[model samples]
Target: MPRNTLIAGGVLVVLGVISYVASAFASVTALIPAFLGVVLVICGLIARKKPMLGVHVALVVALLGLVGTFMNVLKIGEVFAGTAERPLAVVVSAITFVLLLIYIALGVRSFVAARRWKKADAISQA
Candidate 1:
């Protein structure tokens, strides 16, 4: 899970850099993904020492990202229709939303697996 988080963070960071560069550095907002990615990366690193807490932190951050970019889901329609005022921004936001959603799902799956593993280990010990 930590490895996956790191990979996701790297992807998000690259996305932010590409978007910012494409905008000619005119929009600071383009770096939002980068900021979020940095936090995720930190969380990933922390997970190496404290898996539970670090995963929780990373999941929370991802949830926030998903909520923040949720509106872009609607804007995606405009993008497809060629009516979006800022199509690229909308696309970027939608991409972020999807990525966060996937990350959250992965986190949940990891939690479930951990729970099962713990339960099994407890049963064996008993």
Candidate 2:
């Protein structure tokens, strides 16, 4: 596996932990990112050993991250409807949004790398 893939996975796991801990004080909806973080970590670990598996897993994670980020962007207004009442909510939302972007980028990179690795492996075997 590429070093970047491993690094990305590690970063995702750490971010997931952060999200999980941060969610405790935020609304129930915050758990969504927390859950995603765990999934990403598991997939990342698996990908480290099997590029073919990583390709599929990383792609899924990338797609989900994109969708999640898009949905959150659309709902940003609703999230910050009462910014004056709860400033922390805005901060947390922003943090989660940024993390999602980073996660998505890393996932895509890993996915591409995995695909290349798989192709190379096939060529070598033949």
Candidate 3:
């Protein structure tokens, strides 16, 4: 592996581990998607030499989803850190839902891209 790929993979592994651990203590389960995002990032880095455009698109969308989820979680955590309040929770939850919609859209796009890449690969191999 190239140095950059190694570093990127290592970062992704760390991100996955951190998100997994954090989810255990947080109200948000965003960690699960974050873990998936990290895996996609690692896959993307590994496949960089293969020129699979769809896989590359999947990686990019996963990365974006990860970042957006991270931000959404931060906002929720901030709003609920010291409160026993229900209103803040409701507001934050609403915001999270909206962000999730964006994440889902990107996720769908990524899957479509990955499927295209898979078909292309099959044709090439045949």
Q: Model 3, residue 66: what's the lDDT?
A: 49
Report how far residue 53 has shifted in candidate 3, in Å. Answer: 2.6
Off by over 4 Å in 1: none
Q: Pick the candidate with the highest lDDT.
A: 1
Clash counts for all predictions: 0, 0, 0
Between candidates 1 and 2, name the one with more favorable TM-score: 1
**Per-prediction TM-score, please?**
0.97, 0.54, 0.36
Which runs of model 3 end up more than 4 angstroms from their true locations? 1-6, 22-30, 52-55, 63-81, 84-126
- Model 1: per-residue lDDT, tens digit, 55-75? 899999999999998887778
- By summed lDDT, the worst window of 10 consecutive residues in model 2 runs over 83-92
Report the C-alpha displacement of residue 52, candidate 1, in angstroms: 1.0
Q: State how far residue 126 of model 2 sits from its true place (Å).
A: 13
The most accurate candidate by TM-score is: 1
Tens digits of per-residue lDDT for model 3, 35-121:
454555555565566545535544465556546545445455445565434333334334434443554465467568878999999
